[model samples]
Target: MQQLRTPHVVVVMGVAGTGKTTIGPLLAARLGVPYAEGDDFHPQANIDKMSAGVPLDDADRWPWLDAIGAWAHGRAGLGGVVSSSALKRSYRDRLRAAAPGVVFVHLTGDRALIEDRMSHRQGHFMPTALLDSQFATLQPLQPDEAGVAVDVTGSPEEITARAVQALDALSRPAK
Candidate 1:
């Protein structure tokens, strides 16, 4: 039971099929915190657009990002975990503006691996066709950002374990 940025929320981020949904709950459960699925926050319009193989523009995303940010704001101080395909610096910034001190765990994998997973996925609105747009738009976590990048080359459990360990280590007091 380590305090991972006590009073902060963990945003598990990455492109489609990168395991944000899969790993986010594991993170929340491991931390004994509440879990939020990012997809659940999407507006119907957004879903319809992606389902049609259309990529969402920034304009389309702002309101959605803000909504998720609002959720993060609500969870602030209580410490929680949520998943979002927070692909750009601006998106991450927006969430941070809402919930100060929010940290990120960015799951990453190569396009081939991600595509394979995306193809095998069932009932998800996001089409594999838009994965290129996701990758094109992704801006990896930068230095000075309160976050960590995790490679998704392992099983979900391994990824979750790594995320929990990394986050817990981060929140520990400096020697």
Candidate 2:
């Protein structure tokens, strides 16, 4: 097993519909850490693009990722929870650059389930039409990354439990 880092900034990451928003605060509350919403970090321009059903390109995402990263950096050592799609390695790397010893909780599920959830969600800027683009852009957590991948097949509470369990395991001192 990898030697995990101490006190974490946990990022509940996945494509838009994987329940980052739903699970982030719950997980934070469970962990007793402060919660930060990734979507709130987006500037109006990015929100407008996604709201219009246009998939964001790399150039469009860097600043937004950097903003999220800034928040993560600020929470380093302090520990907290924040949610981001973090759909690519490059984006995750940008986050890592700003925040040392950051860990991620990647929520994953199949297409049908994700689309169903996305379709029913209300008042979100991201349109269902752009989910395909999000999956296309997704890069799951790699072996070297400090994180765990939890499937989204269960209820949000169950998923949050899984995340908390996994994070607890990672934080335990080696025997």
Candidate 3:
């Protein structure tokens, strides 16, 4: 594993069913950091809305983003991994506001593959029906964003490895 010059709070971001939950813990373990579940930060109302196939508006997500941001801020120099949908650029900006050094690992994959994974998964509150809205809301990490976009076409381990490699590259200083 590549050593980070300065520990950073990593946010694993993607649409629902992109394996953020699975990858977040593995990435944290690899980096010797704590992990936080983004879903755990959601208010019950938000959960209920998603569970019922209702897409969340920005108003419904502000508190949730703030909660995740607070967790990231607390972990600042200590380094940690957390999962969040963070589908919109504005949402990501909010997170960055709270944790200036936070880096994101955005998972990208084919829509059909994601839907298949969502269908097979059990007990997740986010219904497959919300996926379209998720894609609609997603603003992928732009060139100026401090993040990496890892393709999700492989196994969990493979994807996590890609993320770690990309993050390592990001942490390296220019030669």
How accurate locally, in lDDT, is each candidate?
0.90, 0.89, 0.93
Name the top lDDT candidate: 3
Looking at model 3, residue 39 earns an lDDT score of 98
Candidate 1: tens digits of C-alpha lDDT, residues 1-175: 2234786799999999999999999999988889989888888999999999999999889988888899899998898999998899999999989987789999989999999999999999999999999999999988778888788998999999999878877789767
- List TM-score per model, in order: 0.95, 0.95, 0.96
Question: What ranking emerges by TM-score with the best candidate at the front?
Answer: 3, 2, 1
lDDT of 1: 0.90
Supply candidate 1's per-residue lDDT for 82. Answer: 90
State the TM-score for model 1: 0.95
**Candidates in descending lDDT order:** 3, 1, 2
Q: Which candidate number has the best TM-score?
A: 3
Candidate 3 overall Cα lDDT vs. reference?
0.93
What stretches of model 2 exceed 4 Å from their correct place? 173-175
**lDDT (Cα, tens digit) per residue for candidate 3, span 47-103:** 999999999999999999999999999998899999999998899999999998888
Q: Looking at model 1, report the run of 10 residues with the lowest lDDT sum.
A: 1-10
For all predictions, the C-alpha RMSD in Å is 2.4, 1.3, 2.5
Q: Write the per-residue lDDT of candidate 2 for residues 1-175, one digit (tens) a residue.
A: 3445766798889998999999999999998889999999888998999999898899988988898889988888888999999989888889989896788899999999999999999999999899888888999989888889999998989999998888888778779
